[model samples]
Target: MPLADAKQSDAPAKRERAHAGAVRVVAPARLHLGFLDLNGDLRRMFGSIGLAVDVPRTELVLKRSQTFKGEGPDHARALATLRKLADAYKLPAGYEVKVTSAIPAHAGLGSGTQMALAAGAALMTLEGIDHIPSRLGEMVNRGARSAIGMAAFEQGGFIVDGGRGELDRAPPILVRADFPPAWRALLVMDASTAGVHGEDETNAFAALPPLPADAAAHICRLVLMQLAPGLMEEDIAAFGDALTEIQKIVGNHFAGAQGGSPWTSPGVGRVVGALRAAGGVGIGQSSWGPTGFAFAPSQEIARRLYDSAIEVARREGLEILIAEGRNRGASVEKIANT
Candidate 1:
């Protein structure tokens, strides 16, 4: 359907004009640093920390319609997300949604949650409705397990979330800060492999033993005492060291579910080790597996790490990407209908 002409008036017209056409949103991809606790005394579980990155973002273009129509490589998932929002909010069934740029799915890059939030935000914008991240996340059934993705989508940077207990709301953000601009993250991915997900993911969690009390306490200490302070002081080496330690702890905790190795893919450990040997620091896997990341304090060092690891990654059929930390969140815009 053709977009309704914006009414001519003063205040109301200005508001209408702002949302009279199509709504477009670009949501960032996030790297899951590690979970703080799986077993907690307060009934909370899986508190998490992560950082958003500018590349591999999910981009969507949406407009009101007489019937729901979805287009693009990720159209199926986008349509499902839109339907959930529509049903929950009693919104119209009609919408034309298009996924322009797609994030890599199931690579531990927060693709699913970002896409869902992007679609929901676009629909809300098309309707000229204002919303906070948690509400938008709820409308799309995201932030159920971890709030890091939702918070990153709302406002990029490093985010730490309190664990989810009995609360139906999105996990509260305990900390949020802009990651240092001089540091870069080197992402290594095995495109041929998929991480644990869906029913498999559910079963994996169920079969795993609870996190040990001691490990949880240690992780908390690293995050609070080392990682947080390092960021505050802009000390890359300190932050990187703490992050590496946290990754090792978390990786070992989940090793039972991810085979005998701490990393999901066999080559990940080798790649990480090589990066570290070449001066990269703060190395770890993102989420379930197959995507690994390391930090460098400067672009030159990042490039050096990538160059050194590319040969090893190629031997394992993996691809490497260099991304800087994103200090700002997603962007949404209204495009005038021609």
Candidate 2:
């Protein structure tokens, strides 16, 4: 807890925006992309699309630590999410927290809902409290079933949400946009497999089997007529062909929990099919597998699909790069409390 910099003037404090005390937060590593109404018929379900990237981030910080702790890169899942929001908002759990950098945990990159909404938004600005990021992601369970990581921690762009509506909360932001900043993605990681999260992702959605209401109504008319008019007409081939036909219909219904193969890592699914055969066009796999993505339309076509998938992503261990879309969110500062 020693990070002082309101403007120390060396240009190192913008952990994505916001700076002042021992309360950092950062965030940004979304990209769920797919799941527009997982067939709840009309009662609502898991409508998504997400984006908010800018390369694997999470940050975290907090101050005053005599002991209630956590330390870096998944600090024990950020001290079990700061001991469940410090015992559900009783606050002050003797701060020490420091997840210096995260987002890799389960590989689908929502790293446990962005480390439980960046440890409940840095303990609500170190206990000033005043909730709202879905009520501090409901005291730390961080949006149970996609609100696009609590609206990408409060407003990064290109979202969509509007799903779980029977009153469980979390799914709401029906649209956000602005992701066409010269569009570019790539991603592709695979840090040695890790995606069917906790309790096997609730028993792979209770052993999946329902999605048919006319194929969830034709993937909701390809996200309202071809992915929101190819993201407001930037038109990366009509938004990569409506996000590769909604990731081939939600990766063939989660490909029998990914063993049937929507790719949990068949070498990052052959480097996302050589980054969509080197043209990279909104490929798939992001929220339940060895991280994959593609979508390129600038930055020189994502550096020619990262130099044509950098040697088949290093002969298939995988690691492609090039990200972009993070239209602002997550950044809560307040340093100098050492």
Candidate 3:
């Protein structure tokens, strides 16, 4: 096979191994749209819906090294993830995992989950172990609340997970649908702030009251009737409308955790507000977000909206990028002998 470089990893790659060679895994960044049913009235909680985007991805390489080390953004976390995978699978510890690029950490872009999965999958390839993305996710303690990251890692698209139940490791994919190729997701990012995380996140959940069953039911109806069908039919109005409403409901419920606001970063919230008036739709914050997103029907419209919101984004010290929906999942490929 030809030598694998950065370009080769861009294509859809299959998992493979070569003697003493390097393996690269590209994990996509995902947007956690909203939770469907957080109340657990149906004996399930945190059923979520999300979409995978093409830009802002995590890419990494793994090869046998005399010493165990990792390089690049979140490399420290990557090393820890590797250790977890090694212990769980009984694999050797001698490996160098280089993270070439990664999504912004704690930006509500699923960076942590993507990093864990990419690191684990790279190690799995090098060791010739079983290749299961969800298993890798479980090994790294991902998918505790939403399995959207795991699902996006394995199969990028619009994903809906059945939520956590009796199962321990993986959540069932309730719906997986392709997003319109022409549609765009404009990301509103803030580098200065971080969303609620770790112990704080846990505490926030504990402090919050349980969601009302009727509210959960409303969200379910929105997803099942509007979002899903709108996506399938490529009706941005219907889909974006549903998504916007869902975000409102989920945001209001979590507002107490976010200082009585739907957004974690007020700057991001401001920019998203401007973008909304600029013709962007499906506006919402991702996860416990300092990062927010809005959708447009086409790149042209997205760019136009982006331009219109540039001044507002600049004032808020935020960044904006246009991204298409990713229909394909993460890829793993082996490079020639290192």
Q: List TM-score per model, in order.
A: 0.92, 0.34, 0.93
Superior candidate under lDDT, 1 versus 3: 3
Tens digits of per-residue lDDT, candidate 1, 1-338, equal: 00121111123323543457788899999999999998677599889989999887899898877888988867778888777666555563478888888888988999888998888788767766556777677656677778999889888999999988886777889999999998899988887777888789889888878888888988999999999889878898899999999999888888988886778887877888899999988999998977889999888989988999999989988888999899898998988653
**Candidate ranking (TM-score, best to worst):** 3, 1, 2
**lDDT (CA) for every model shown?**
0.83, 0.77, 0.86
Clashes of each: 1, 7, 0
Task: Give model 3's TM-score versus the native structure.
Answer: 0.93
- Candidate 3 residue 299 C-alpha distance from true site, Å: 0.5
- How far is each candidate from the true structure, as Cα RMSD in Å? 5.0, 17.6, 6.2
Higher-TM-score candidate among 1 and 3? 3
Candidate 3 C-alpha lDDT tens digits along 1-338: 11122123421222332345888889899999999887886788889899999889999888877778978988988888877655555453467888889999989999999998888788777766665777667657788888899999999999999888876656788999998999999999999999898999999988988789999999999999999999999999999999999999999999999999999998998899888988889999999989899999999999999999989999889899899999999999988754
Per-residue lDDT of model 2, residues 141-201, tens digit only: 6667788877887888888888788886677787888788888888889787788888879
The C-alpha local distance difference test score for the whole of candidate 3 amounts to: 0.86
